[model samples]
Target: MIDTRWWQRGIFYQVYPRSFQDTDGDGIGDLDGIRRRLDYLAGLGVDAIWVSPIYPSPMADFGYDVADYCGIHPMFGDLEAFDRLVADVHARGLKLVLDFVPNHTSDQHLWFRESRASRDNPKRDWYIWRDPAPDGGPPNNWISNFGGPAWTLDAASGQYYYHAFLKEQPDLNWRNPEVRAAMHDVLRFWMARGVDGFRVDVIWHLMKDADFRDNPPNPGYRPEEGDIGRFLQTHSADQPEVHDIIAELRRVVDEFPDRVLIGEIYLPIDRLVAYYGEDLAGAHLPFNFQLIYASWNAESLAALIEEYEGSLPRGGWPNWVLGNHDRPRIASRVGHDRARAAAVLLLTLRGTPTMYYGDEIGMENVPISPEDVHDPWEKNEPGLGLGRDPERTPMQWDASPNAGFTAGRPWLPVAANFAHCNVAAMLDDPFSILALYRRLIALRRVHPALQTGSYRPVTAHGDVLAYQRELGGESLFVVLNLGGETQRGIALPDGVAEGHVLLSTRLDREEKVTSGFSLRAHEGLVIALSAAT
Candidate 1:
């Protein structure tokens, strides 16, 4: 055991700063806006807040493409504002985690500029630059994640630079010792500033295969059915050299006590566990994205939970994320009716839970008109329409103009009928999904079993999902209906549990209905284990 502390318990609020709050009237969010929302976050009872990248960038990849590792981006406010935000977050008993993008940098960044200045510059080898093929083509056929060639020809240097993502953001050559040292210095700079931790970006893609062989063709590449999931680029990337780099990053974290590193790795659970490092020196939590990939069915999820728990080595801590900026929000995945059940299950699960900014109120993805879309993904794919703008819509504070995001038009349109799903209205209505989330968090806090308990799956037929969490002296049973129809006679196995319905998002109006506890359609119930029985 790693001697768990304050960080091990409770939830984390992930704020996508650009869409979180815009303190300035420039139609963009900034650090000061985050400072203003501290009380709102503290009221939500999360131990810390994870801010997406606010570093200097050209906005090509929207802050993911960094120009300066240590400096704050002018659009997100200056360095002083970040310092103040850190101080304010700490003052309110909250930890602040900044996003670190060590995988790549904006081509406009000085480092890339220096590297491009000459083929023999001291920094030329810091980034991956390759020679053109015999036919004046890209070095390889590997595609950038955003589409097109991953390699871009630099006219000034007469060489091709590699970017796993966008051409504007060149990937760093971690194989170089200088590059690794510089990345560590970036960590040291932030640690010196009192920042609590970093959300390391693209940890799995840190190092590339040395031979640079071509990725095998995807025989199962079916765009209509998401068959790209099976195209393993075996000879292309995710090399073993990545572990050496992770150890170096872990060493930097070790120098600063209590500082944590969370990785954005997309590997399977078995491979993901290796990121925890042999001596617990790698990523503190290589994000478990199983929920995103699992079939939205009860039996499959139950099996996945069992597998997820079984895959962890003793002393390895697990973290669960339901939504992020890149994926569709949780409400959109399973639809609005089942959002509460998802919330109950997410909060009730026994690992760190991360909630997207507007997920608490059951905010669905907005409609992204092709003409108004800004995501490069949508731009590249054209008809695919898989961009993230809809999920990343401005937070709906109220039903007012622009959803109170700004007096000016928001960067993206707010969801239609915002009046019905606004946070302000939800706060006013006692039966709102927002209130249900607040209660769900409170229940998790009040019950030690819910926070750090051992999870056990209960067998049940149909779309009914059931599980139990047990701790030192208490246990709580969770019953959820993931489908539309009502499930009944959920006999609680041997019915040893005798406690009243602890909380329910749907049972509020029908408390006296029957069965002592009957789950309504798309509903959830958390009941304490009755002591006498």
Candidate 2:
């Protein structure tokens, strides 16, 4: 079978819809806002746009706690607007990947409402509900990911409901065949509407321990790590049955042509790759988030990449991510100078690269004041700096009022440097971070080596990570200087006597190398090596 799936080689750009753009002066981004910016996304060269959840919800955990799986949120737009957005995305030859919230539903969802109505209700089994322990307290020691107890008492029903993150976001009982079919049907609803695929949210948390055992304590956890780390989550997440459910989802997605299923799994590399399933029957792209958590050092990162690459199931492709809605912006994590080099590292690596929206313009995390804070996690757990609000701020399109995101107030404040560090400003500057990203993406599209080639780690000394991507006798060497000091006499492999710089993170420097190359502080370059003589 020829593997020509679009997601396999193409790049992904994730947009947090509520902060993307506002079209109706409603102070919130809508589907039309995204529609208006489709051209911008195309110009950026992303193969698809994975918009965060825009479904009807009570705003408990933003759109993750979905109220209706098939309906668009009124705040975002109606079905008509969504149809137009889908049309526009397709019109530009781009794919649309919706955020599929399968693990939980809003308390306001009809299913949840029916389930919590009464113990004898027909829909009572739709969600995870349990009777209290003999002492009349909560069911178990499982704690909510946000904070406090995971079980919530329902006075009206005389039972307690389980939630992974927020009480208002109840976990669905995937052990029930009915719930699995229902969620699969939801995928059908979107696929029928022309959505190319789905990035399933919190996919590993779909099934829990059938016995409802208490999660064992995590001995490595510290007070500063927040309540979630207090337990190993042995009974609450990554259950064995989740693979069956993921395979079912894969079967549903396979029913449609050229569609992809991406699972948002945060397990160790060994366990994370299991989502690929035997014979490649599971998620087409089990999102690799190791880069997001690994130490930003060359030695450690090189080892991490090797481990991930070494773990893939036969015929399984690789993917990479630098940042996301839940994590701090890349610039904030690695600093501005290193972010440019990081871009080269991300795009030049051997996999599908998922870029966060504001990353192209090098947007950092915006500071959110307590008065303006709105993330439910932060609200649930005070003063832990656990809230995602800082990273979910509005995208800075231009240097206009509200950073050109909206005419009215934005849902969150734009990053402080938006005036000069934005698309408009970067478009005109050849050396800007956005230019580097665009250049790297364009380069990747033209070069088969960087697209789906084999990756081989190259040896280089301290603070420098080197690798080569090769296909059909053509090779691209990526050398990154993760440190601040210039490195001299970096040796090229034998038979690779000469090559010219294809693209450099430094932007100003380009050269033809003979035997060796020197890297400046925090610099990276992609060199096209001459075929071995």
Candidate 3:
């Protein structure tokens, strides 16, 4: 095996900058605030942090709409603050990964402004613009992933610009050579500033169908699946040409030694693996989102893991994410009890795992009233159960007001249970979720089998999901009870007659086991098996 890269063996903590910590009393988290929290993150044992977008933006899509690719947002900080933050992050012996929004730019961006100035402008081709159909309507039946028509009429030019998301964020024409060159330079600008890597956003949407064909109607569509799911998105996303773009992007990143590229893709296991590129040249790790949307059950999750493992390209690394800025917190989805077990499951799996900012403390989604909702999707399509505000609440650092995330009022309200679930409350409690996460992270670091070993699923009836990770004569067995009630006498895999329980999600004392092992409801544990001579 190629020597394992730091990113491959390390745990990734994703910090949504807006909600991580606020230092300027502006009700928003900034670079300075993040710099102040480096000690806390290091204490948590995470190897690196993948920060969400902090670049200059109009906040149209909450910083996804980049108005300036090479500059920090005023709300976050200036170049000096960002440079200091990077230096501090490296000083802590942790890597920093910035969110790179490559598919589009804010309508207010200089390039977009020039593109929209006139039909004959030199940068007119920088964005996707087309003349209206004969009926004076949109060019096709394509709809934005956010809601409504994908094409927004530009009255000044008598044309319509297409957006995969909000109209304020127009999709860039990656087909244009100039646009590709400009975006590549954005990478170089940050690389020179000492960034460790980037998590490219919406990478699959970089190349839409050249003919602008209408997406097909979804046969599995349901009223509750949101407007974006009303169609299959076959033509508008996952076009084959997108691979070439990814290959070129990878080439640019390779110029910087020890730097990596991560792509955020929500495609199927087979298609998602393609982003790794032929010869493993695309994304170093295409964010695996199977656990994010999979059914919360043992059978389903086991099948999903097997499918993903079977689909990986030769020499391709794997990664897992349970929660992120765009999704509901894992504690909210699977209940606080099961989230502990999920944490063990996530970290023990044979791959790199990413933890959302507040998940280590068992943070759940806070309810957001209609007036408090800030997500563009919820505003555009009301009552679709699509608002992300609940999951984007400020980090609950302590019991203080606003969860100690800000000196002033936070951009989003802290969870009501913050007092009990805050980091301070869990810091010393051995049974707390935060403690469980730290233990799991530490175990992963010390155990080579848990880091780069091969995964072999063991047959376990009922709600028990069991697997073994073996490497260099070291074998670790992980078993999880995903059910709501106690499960007894779970048969250990044959030939694993005796072992020592190294750690348990409950943070209880280790025990020696033989043949059969019983598990409490929502319990998970790792047992170290004796190596065969």
lDDT of each prediction vs. the true structure? 0.82, 0.90, 0.91
Clashing pairs in 1: none
What is model 3's C-alpha RMSD?
1.2
lDDT of 2 by residue, 1-533 (tens): 12567897899999999999898987799999999999999998899999999999989888998999999999999999999999999999999999999999999999999998888888899999999999999999999989899999999878999999899899999988999899889999999999999999999999999999999989899877688999998989999888988999999999999999999998999999999987899999999998888787888999999998999998889999999999999999999999998899889888899999999998998889999999988887779888899999888889998889999988898888889988889999998999999899999888989988889999645899999999887888899999999988876766787888988896887789876679999999889998666
Please provide, for model 1 over 1-533, each residue's C-alpha lDDT reduced to its tens digit, 9 standing for 90 to 100. Answer: 22465556758788999887776787777888888878878877777899999888888888889999989888888889989998999999989888999999999889999998999999999999899988989987777777667899988778999998889989999999999999999999998998888889998898887867777777777674232333455644667778778988988987998888888988887788888887777888888889877777789888888888998877777788888899898888887767788888888987888888999988888888878888887777677666888888888888888777767767888888688788788888888888888888888878888878888888655888888889877777788887778777776645464655788866384232223456678888887776543
RMSD of 2: 1.2
Q: What's the best-to-worst order under lDDT? A: 3, 2, 1
TM-score of 3: 0.98
TM-score for candidate 1, please give it.
0.95
Count of clashing residue pairs in every prediction: 0, 0, 0
After aligning candidate 2 to the native by TM-score, how far in Å is the CA of 267 from where it should be? 0.7
Worst 10 contiguous positions by lDDT, candidate 1: 507-516
For candidate 3, write residues 1-533 as lDDT tens digits: 33799999898999999999999899999999999999999999999999999999999999999999999999999999999998999998999999999999999999999999999999999999988999999998888988889999999889999999999999999999999999999999999999999999999999999998888899999977678888988999899999999999999998999998999999999899999998998999999999999887888999999999999988888899999999999999999989998999899888899999999999899999888999999999888889899999999999888889998988888899888889999997888989998898889878888989999999545789999998877889999999989888876667666889999889995988877668899999899986433
